[model samples]
Target: MTEHQDAQGQHAPTTPPAEPAVKSAGPSPEMLELAGRMFDAARTGDVDTLEAYIVAGLNPDLQNGKGDTFLTLAAYHDQPAVVEMLIRVGADVEKANDRGQRPLTCATFKGDAASMRLLLAAGADPDAGTPSARQTAQMFGGERVAAVLDEAR
Candidate 1:
C-alpha cells in the first residue's frame, strides 16, 4: 500500500532521551540485585550460599529494601543456623528495619522461641526498637516467646 508523505518529503525530527546531569555514586543495579539475593539467602536459610558470600567479602550487614539486616530476616524466618552464623560473623542484631522492627522483635512477632533465645544470648537488647520484643510478644499473644524475652531482661 502507498502512504501519503509531506510535499517536502521530510521526516519528523525527534530528540533522544537526555542523560542525567550527574553520574550516580551508588552501587550499580547489578550489585544491589546480588546483595538482595544474599538477604534472601539469610531469610531462606541458604546457609552454604550465604556463608560463601560473607566469606567472599559481602557485608554481613546488608539490608533489604525495608532496611532489614541479615540477622533480622534470619531471626524472623526462624532460620536458626543462619542466625547463628550471622551472629558468629558479628552481624548487628540491633539494626532495625525501616519500620523500626529489630531482629529480636521480629522473632517474638513470629513466636520463634529458638531465635529469641539465640538473639538474647548474642546480646540483643530486648528493649531496643519500637514495640520491643517483650511488647511484641505480649501484644501478639506470644506467651512462650514472651517468657524467653523476660528471662533476658
Candidate 2:
C-alpha cells in the first residue's frame, strides 16, 4: 500500500477509492431522435435542416440501421438540392445499402434523369451494387436514365 496526501495535506496510508468505470449504453434517445430527424430531412428534401446538421459535426456518411445513407434517401426521393449538398459535403456516392442498393440505383429506379445525371457527375458508379444502376434502369423502365448512364461511360 502506498501512502498519499489527504485533503488536509496529511499523509494517509490509503489512497482515495478509484472511480468506477462508466459503462456505455450505446446511443442516447436524443441522438436516436436526431438521427431520425436527419433521415426524415433527407427523405423529404429538407436541405436546410440537413445542411445545418451536417455543419454541426453530424457525419454526412452516417448510415441507418439497414445501411442506407443520406445520399441514398435523397436520391431515391429525387431531392436535387439534398443530393447536391450531400455530394459536396463528402457523402459517399457509391456506398451500397444492406440490400446492396446504391444512390445511383435509387435514382435510376425512379427514372429521375436529373438525379441520375447529378449522381453520375458526382462519381456515382452506374454499375455499382446488387442491381447495377444500368440493370435497375432496365428493370424499372428508366430508359432515359439508362441512356444517360451509357453516355456517361
Winning model by TM-score = 2
Candidate 2 C-alpha lDDT tens digits along 58-105: 999999999999999998998988999998999999999999999999
lDDT of 1 by residue, 19-92 (tens): 89999889998998888788889889999999988988988988887888988999889898998898888899
TM-score of each: 0.81, 0.84
lDDT leader: 2
Deviation from native of the Cα of residue 47 in model 1, angstroms: 0.9
What lDDT does model 1 reach? Answer: 0.86
Q: What's model 2's overall lDDT?
A: 0.90
**What's the true lDDT of residue 54 in model 1?**
92
Q: Each candidate's lDDT (Cα)? A: 0.86, 0.90
Q: 61 in model 2: Cα distance from truth in Å?
A: 0.7
lDDT of 2 at 23: 73
Q: Which segments of candidate 2 are over 4 A away from where they belong? A: 1-20
Clashing pairs in 2: none
TM-score, cand. 2 vs. native: 0.84
